[model samples]
Target: MAPTLRLLAAELARRCDQDGPHADGTGTGGVAEMERAALLPPGKLLRPLLFTESAAATGMRRADTLAAALGVERLHVGSLVHDDVIDGDTQRRGRPSVVARYGLPNAIVTGDALLIGAFREVAAHTPASVPDARRLAVVQTLAEAGVDLCRGQAMEDELRAQGDRDVDRYLRMISLKTGALFRASCLGGAQLAGAPAAAQHALTRYAEHLGRAFQMADDLLPHTSDTATSGKSALSDLRNARPTFPVLLCWHRTNEQGRAQLSALLAGTLPAETAMETLRVLLRESGALTQARAAARAEAAQAKAALDELPATEARAALHAVADLAVDRDR
Candidate 1:
């Protein structure tokens, strides 16, 4: 699994590098220097690689499979850049975020460029042997995912505006915001491989469960992991006022006095250190972390179960390993 995941990540990086045009050719004119400096170098590329492996497990030829995997990753990265701006984040992968380095407008354009570039890459590799309908379906699927991504963001914004989301509501919001892309990743991969409907459905289920577990782990990371280890701010989730699994869980389990403390923190008047301290106290006293961990474990099990529908193979084994990794990741 380690070797396969590494190879998948490397392949995704290679495709990302290949997809980029020269700096001058990237965004608008007169912005090439800034754009070049702000280029979001690829991250772990885990999603794309996993996606490609899923495709290969269904018998897609290696040469014909790379483009779709790269395309999927490009969409994921582009969304992240735009999402950072939306979330007012300043750092990513231990570096300045695109908006932080190049301003919001440029970051938006860069993300847009990545989106177009992804489609171009996908289109270029459509083998004549593959039906035109198949290519169109892939493109349409990606476009729909993009739309869902935007809808998810909008839903989060609505929740934030309300500012008093409960546990179930936050779960629903994050499920849409994060789970949609994971579903797309698996669905797209299976489609590219011409996998049977049953197989695709199983993979999609696996992705949704894994996505929920991944987000749960991510929500925990800000509180549990160090910045140096996580490659992002350790407390950004609280600082940004984003409702996470632990926060909601704590909100549910805490007594009135605890809720008052949390409410004060949410009111945005407390100092940063004090606010974080309050959050930590609420989480610890309410046993929210334990509950969140239990939920993640449950989701990871469900994700693994989804693989039961697939034929036993190295790829299936890797998928199960990934589920465990997602749930157990500390950073």
Candidate 2:
């Protein structure tokens, strides 16, 4: 890890501890406690790190940025908890999922607590002691982004349920579900620093492209890696009947026989091993992995271009490193 990134992650992790509420009074206190512990592991911590690095690059003090960064990450973690429940997933980060460990109701409540707490943190720290309007604007932007994410997720669910196979539809789903948060993270960092509009907008573009690349990489990991490495079931997406970028690409490129194989996998009833094998075959035969890598390269190039507006500095370099890592990361 970069020195700056390590420092930022440590600071945000500390803030999360300080800002995150104890579960004792909540209905799902036990689950909340587990969630708390889960946050400190050696996972990517990508969103908070990105937010902090972006802010630092634009002259935001580490102290000034921590609360917002932590808040965003908390919101992200909350969403993942809720997502696991919705998808009926039983594991995350290689352990039993919140719902599996503490039942769905408690998991839901824990997620709600995180979201509410995130908003509160943003409200308390922004505006920088000026007129409160700017602070409110940040909150509003973040709130709307979260809502858009839910809408995007709903759209994806609907499409998959209806057996939609179009690549455009999948892109729309990823843009909203994944890209919104990325945009919000970048914008939030810039807003907190009172950065110029050009810098803010530049980071926004960088984040948007990086976000899509990140999701594409995430979507590709299952077929290329094992469950132990990915920290979740390798076949989970397949079992959930979700159509990822690679799968969508293969579906679009394959001939009739290959399409039939993919359709059989999508019947919402394949065994885990069979689904994994089908995905492997599709990726290999259709060259979907190659295409996915090329797409990621294009996005990474766009991300790098967006950084041209920022002053040359270690922090800017860190941001670029993150963009590169997003496309090349194994998990």
Candidate 3:
């Protein structure tokens, strides 16, 4: 991470530790605080990094920009907390997940607390130079992103239940689930910098494509990386029977025998470990892994192209690097 981003991440972590309501009724020093703190620990901080970098690209690095960045990070962390619960994941970043440590109900409340803290952080700390109307716009952006995020999560659940294989539908769902916040992060920074509408639109597109690339790469991690490398169980997605990009692509490209094997695995007819091993083989043999990687690389290229519309600067160069990072990250 760059020095500025590292500083911003540290500040955001401090804020998360200090601002939220305690999980325990005592309001301090309890399991709730511990859970909240655990969730906010240093990680990629990708959303906030995007926000700060976007703001910098617009030649704006005001206090409000940092505040917006922090807000986005909080929202991202909250989503992860809830995602672990929904996926029944017991591990995150190589540690026991909040759901695993505190149980589901507490984890739910912990996520909600972080979300509420995100709004409060935005409302209280947006730069003083920003006018009231612009600040309100930033708040509205966060609110809409949150709504779309929930809708996407629900859509994912429905798709999983129905075992939908339409790649386009999956793309749209991920755009909502993952891309919405990325869009919001970029928009918040641009808005904070008071960039014109054209620039904001460009950054939004950059974020959208970059987000898709990030998620697609992430979807491949279970097949390509181990638990130690990826920081979560490799079988988590398979265990939940989630129809990830690789799985769907493999299904579409493979022979009937391969499809039947995948179906049996997803239907829980095969042992979990054996099923995952078979699915991995099927994906590799069908060229689905290669295709999925190509898709991610294509999205990253689109993201970089979008940066061309922005004013040329070192920040823009950094954003270009971010696009590469999205697809190339190992974890």
Instruction: Pick the TM-score winner.
Output: 3
lDDT of 3 by residue, 247-267 (tens): 999999999999899888888
Of candidates 2 and 1, the better by TM-score: 2
Summed backbone clashes in each candidate are: 0, 0, 1
Instruction: Tell me the alpha-carbon RMSD of every candidate.
Output: 2.7, 2.5, 2.1
Q: How many backbone clashes does candidate 1 have?
A: 0
Tell me the TM-score of each prediction against the true structure. 0.91, 0.92, 0.95
User: Model 1, range 1-331, lDDT digits (tens) per residue?
Assistant: 5665566556655644454456557533434333334443556566776677677667776456667767777788778878888778888888888889889888888788767766775677756676666666677777887887788788777776688557777777767788877887777777877889999889989988998899998899877877778878765666667778888888889889988887778767798777887788789889999999999989999999999999888878878888998878766
Considering summed lDDT, which 10 consecutive residues are worst modelled in model 1?
27-36
- Model 1 misplaced regions, further than 4 Å: 2-41, 126-128
Clashes of 3: 1
Answer with 2 or 3, whichever has the higher TM-score.
3
Compared with the true structure, all predictions reach lDDT values of 0.76, 0.80, 0.85
lDDT (0-100) at residue 44 of candidate 1?
A: 59
Higher lDDT: candidate 1 or 3? 3
Q: What is the lDDT of residue 227 in candidate 1?
A: 79
